[model samples]
Target: MLTMAIVILLLLMCATIPVAVTLIILAFVLGYFYSDFPFYLAAGEVLWTNSENYTLIAIPLFVLIGEILVRCGSARKAYSIMDAWLSWLPGGLIHANIGASVLFSATSGSSVATAATISTIALPEGRRLGYSEGIFSGAVAAGGTLGILIPPSISLIIYGIFTETSIPKLFAAGVIPGLLLAALFCFVTIVCSVIKPSISGQRAKYNWKTRIVGLFSLMPLFLLFFVVVGSIYAGLATPTEAAAIGVLAAVGIAAAGRSFSIAMFTDAVLGSLRTTAMIMLIVLASYFLNFVLSTLGINEQIEALFSGMNLSALETLLLVFCIYIVLGMFIETLSLMVITLPVLAPIVFAQGFDKVWFGVVVIILIEMALITPPVGLNLYVVQGVRKRGSIMDIVVGALPYVLAMFVLLYILVIYPQVALYLPNKV
Candidate 1:
């Protein structure tokens, strides 16, 4: 049944149908063929319950913050400030792409938004400064993937909802790994620039006073990240409530930038509404499909099958890792998560892995998907911003960072404490 579902899913995805609609169709097809019970009757209640989950409220609030930042020109200003501070690094201005992306991802909660924001600001600068297209473009795309791994992550929220895990704990678990992953990307750029020397452009010098002034420009973002993530960490607010606070803080940032207006606010609302609706549809449809899988006992079957194999925990984990790498190559990240969690979540837990740890693990896999080829959204977003070069340059550039992700994954596997420490300690 599991194999059949994958085959049918791939077939439907090959059609022009929307992924949400395809998931719905897959649920119906599987129910009719494999289930003894009437599954459709249960879908409405299950989907509605999942739709009404309060944790979902965080997604739009997070998205709205990103939209406001985008429209208010904060991303552009933030990128310039980051460039000023990081320009003297080994990789020159390219390090600013990663730095600016880390700041935006901490608040934006959407990988695509972070990628697009940095791409818009940094691509022209790269062109003007003679930076290597492959490495520069790759840095932007790879850095943007952090949006999903960092706190206030939309993907983490969805993962929490699906697994019935603590959203706050999941958020906490992501912080250390997320920051470390950001550092790893910088380390890669540094190594590559040191090895090749031509991968980066000329380094520019900044006066101490100039760098200090630019730091002031970045204070709003830091303070905003602090308020939002800090509140959640301090137990002063739930993720949803903290997201509400983030929206207000983002608007203030926009207003301070002199970029906020009635018209700008309206645009941000509409943009958020559109993104939210699409995400909710995918969420609801995947839940309905999960209900069908449960009714058919497919998850149980997969669990029994895995147990039957007599695989050790580490072996099972390596197999699952390989599965995600293959799936990430083709599926959209959100659809991939929602569709697979029902089947894999039980198998993972039965193997004695913590759901919270698995949640972070899955998010890192999703981050990998974002920069990968064929369907890597960040790759396309970065390439689109460049508009003149072959997309292959960006793809080639991103390979090293892909290796960086693999390195981080290896560390987490060997020492789960790296991911579990923050959540466990807090």
Candidate 2:
């Protein structure tokens, strides 16, 4: 039954059907063939429970905040401030791309929104400054993945809720690893620039006065970051409430900037609704499918298979990591997490791994899913922003960062403290 469901889903995906529809179809098929429950009743229950999730409210709110920042020109302002500080590096604007993305990730929760926001602001600058499409687009796609790895992350919240871990601690744990990955991306950009100077543009120099002046424009981002993440850590707000705070803060910033016209506001809200609806549909369907699979004893089958392997804890984890990379290639990030977390997380915990550390590691894999092929949302985002570049350009550009992610993954494996240190100290 599982094989049939996967095969049907794959064929539908190959036929270019929408992912949400594919998932729904598979859920219905599985419900009919694999369970005694009526298909309609099962589907309705799944949809209802998925949409009624209070925690899931964070998804749309965070997305709306990101959209407002983009529409109100706050995204550009933040990028400009980052550029002022980082544009003198070897990769010039590419380093700024990474830096700006890391900053935006601190506030934003959606990787696609982060990629879209940064690409809208930074893609033009790369072209205006004659930077290569490969590196420029690649940097935005790769760096934007930080949205899920940094604090105030929607992904981590979902993971925490699913696994019954502390959301604040998960958010805190992501900080050091997120920053480390950002730094690694910058380092990779510099190394690439030095090796192939043709991919880089002339470095920009800014006086201290100009740089300091630019910093003022970044206050909105910093404020939003504090309101969202600070509220979580201070125990003042749940992750959902923090998301609401972020949305209100974004609106205020847009109004303050005089960029909040009715049209822009409407567009931001609509974009948020559309994205949220799409994400919710897939999430709901995945839950229904997972329910059916669990009832059919698929989870037990998987656990039995793993138990029979008799592998060491580290070996079991490495195997799970390998599975995530393969699955990530074809699965959407949120859906992938929702489907696998219930089944895989317990296995990891039973192996004596820290849930917080595994959360960070899973986030890095999710980040990879954003830029990987066949279904890489970030690749399509960067591609949509550019009129002339091939999708291959973005994929090739993200390859270096993919390797960087592998190295980061290995480092985390050896030294779980990288993820655990900040949360533990705090």
Candidate 3:
């Protein structure tokens, strides 16, 4: 039954059917053949349980916040500030792309939003300055992946809720690794620039006075980050509540800047609704499929398979990491997390790995998913913003960062403390 379902899903995906509908079809087909449960009942139950999740409310709020930031010019201000700070690097605005993404990731919780915001602000600059579209788009696509790895991340909140882990601890755990990945991205950009100076644009330096002026435009984002993330860690609000706080704060910032038009608000709300609906549909379908798979004992089968391998815990972990990377290439990020976390987290925890560390590692892999071919959300987003670039260019450009991610993945494996240390101390 599982084999048939897999075959059907592959065919549907290859045919370019929507992922949510594909998942629902697979779930119903599997449930009908493998179990005596009524397909409609199972489907309805799955949909209700997944949609009724209180934690899932954060998804829209975060999406709304991101839209508001983009509308109100916070995202552009962030890019300007990062450009002032990092444009002197070998890759010029490429570094700013990554830098702005890292900073925006601190405030925004959605990868698509991060990519859209950064690409909207930075892509024109790249073109105007005669930078390579491949590198520029790739940087935005890759940098946007940081949205899931930083604090106040909607993905982490969802992960924690699904896995029954501490969201605050998971948020804390991501901070160090998120910052490290940002630094590594900058380093790689510099190295690539030095090796191929032609691909890198002309380096620009700003006077201190100009840099300081740029800093003022960045304060809104900084304050948003502090309020959202700080509220969570300080025990002042739940993750969902903090997201609400973020939404309100974002609106205030927009109003203060006089960018808060009714049309902007309508667009923000409608955009949030569209994105949230899309995400929730896949999420609901994946949850149902996961439920069916769990009922059919797939998790047990997986656990037994791992146990039968007689591998050490670390070896088992590396194997699972590889699985995520492979699955990431085909699956949407939220669906990927929903389908795997329930099955994988238990095995990981049984091996005595810190839940928080595993969360960061999973998020890094999720970031890779955002840039991979065939189904990378960020790749599509960056491509959508480009009037002419092939999707392959974005994928090719993201290759360097994908390699960097693998290196960082190994580092996290060897030094789990990179993710766990801050959470532990705090």
Point to the candidate with the largest lDDT: 1
- Give the whole-model CA lDDT for all candidates, comma-separated: 0.89, 0.86, 0.86
Question: Best TM-score goes to which candidate?
Answer: 1
Candidate 2, superposed: residue stretches over 4 Å from native: none
TM-score per candidate: 0.97, 0.95, 0.96
By lDDT, the better pick of 1 and 2 is 1
lDDT minimum window of 10 residues, candidate 2 = 37-46
Steric clash count of candidate 3: 0
Error of 3 at 197 (Å): 0.6
* Candidate 2, pairs of clashing residues: none
What does candidate 1 score on TM? 0.97
lDDT string, candidate 3, 94-155, tens digits:
99999899888887788888998899888888988888888778989999999999887878
lDDT of 2 by residue, 1-426 (tens): 657876987798788887778777876777778778776776777678767878888888888888788888877887888888998888888988888888888877778888988998888888888889997899999988999998878789889877888888999999999999999999999899899999987667789999988887787788889988899888899888998988899899989989988999999999989988887777777777777777777778788889999999989998999989999999888878987897899899999999999999999998999999978989999899987858999899999999999999999988989899878975
lDDT over C-alpha atoms for residue 161 of model 2: 73
Q: After superposition, how far is residue 201 of candidate 1 from its true place, in Å?
A: 1.7
Candidate 1 residue 382 C-alpha distance from true site, Å: 1.3
Clashes of each: 0, 0, 0
